[model samples]
Target: MKNRMTLTFDSRSENESLARVTVSGFMAPLDPTMEEMMDVKTVVSEAVTNAIIHGYDSEDGKDIELHCAYENDELVIVISDNGSGIEDVEMAKEPLYTSKPELERSGMGFTIMENFMDHVLVTSSPGNGTRVELRKKMVAKDRVCH
Candidate 1:
């Protein structure tokens, strides 16, 4: 079975949870383990946060796009933003590299997503936009009810 969903919302901090919850609910039918579900939610949160903070520079009224597709135990997620794109994707992926030092950003968003997901790909260009693609293979746990 294959399932897919696409969501576009304003780039706001409050909408971050909305994105996470929507993705989680969308994947519920696959019977993913708690750990796997959490991983998905965490990555979604990170991507949305990056879109708002770094991509759009916290500018209101911008739109952040999230697309998810699940098939054959594999889930693919893509988050994109039409805000200011990344100049150096390599440097941004490095751990502890924050463009905004004043905000005390840890700059571990990409690192966390890469660690949790099976694969992570980032495509961006200055003044263009950014698209983050994450993929994960899920194994459904056998539930034993008492």
Candidate 2:
């Protein structure tokens, strides 16, 4: 059986945790490991934070959208913002490359997503906003009790 969820919220920094928790709950049926859960939450945070900070410049009035779909062993998530889009996605994906350096940002958002998820796809235009799609396949857990 396939399951899906969508959440749209204000582009506020405080709402980042909300997005993370919502996704984690939605993924409960997957029986994901603690590490998998944390990775998913962290990626959600990164995407939502990017929308709030970089996309809207921390303006706090725009909207950030999150869509998730999953089945028995696969999950796919897409987070998008209709704020200022990326000018060069390739450059943005580089490790330690942050456009807003003065904010003390680490610029590891994309890198982290890439590391944790099985696949990451980014699409953006200068004025069309940005979308990040993350896909992962869950591995069966080993329930060995010693």
Candidate 3:
């Protein structure tokens, strides 16, 4: 059996938690291991942060959309925003590379997403928008303590 869910939220750091909670709820029924939960949470955080910081430039009223599908023994998450897209995605992926150096960003958003998820794909264009998709294998819980 597989499950799917999608959520849209305003582009704000505060709303990142909502995204995590929604994903956590969807995965709860699957009884994911603790490490799986952490991976999901971290990836969601990085994606949401990118949407707010890079996409929207921390501007208020922008929107971010999150879509998740659990199927084929895997969990796939996609985060999208209709804000200023990256001009150079390849450069952004480099370690310690950041356009907003003044903000003290580590510029590791894409890198972290790649590391945390089994697979990550990014699509974007200047003035168009950005979408980050992450996929991870779902490991079913092995023990049930009641």
lDDT of 2 by residue, 1-146 (tens): 58998989999888999999999999988888999999999999999999889899999879899999998689999999998999999999999999999999999999999999999999999889999999999888764631
* lDDT, ranked from best to worst: 1, 2, 3
2 or 3: which has the higher TM-score? 2
* lDDT tens per residue, model 1, 15-119: 999999999999887788899999999999999999999999999799999999999689999999998999999999999899998998998999999999999
- Report the C-alpha displacement of residue 45, candidate 3, in angstroms: 0.4
Off by over 4 Å in 3: 140-146
**Cα distance off (Å), candidate 3, residue 21:** 1.2
Go through the candidates in order and give each one's C-alpha lDDT.
Answer: 0.93, 0.93, 0.87
Distance (Å) between predicted and true CA of 44, model 2? Answer: 0.5
Query: Per-prediction RMSD in angstroms?
Result: 2.4, 2.7, 2.2
- Residue 34 displacement in candidate 1 (angstroms): 0.8
lDDT of 3 by residue, 1-146 (tens): 58787888888788989999988988776678898899899899989998999999999698899999987568889999999999988988897898999999988877888888899899999999999989998764565652
Per-model TM-score on C-alpha atoms: 0.95, 0.95, 0.92
Angstrom error at residue 72, model 2: 2.1
Query: Model 1, stretches more than 4 Å misplaced?
Result: 143-146
- 1 or 3, which is superior by TM-score? 1
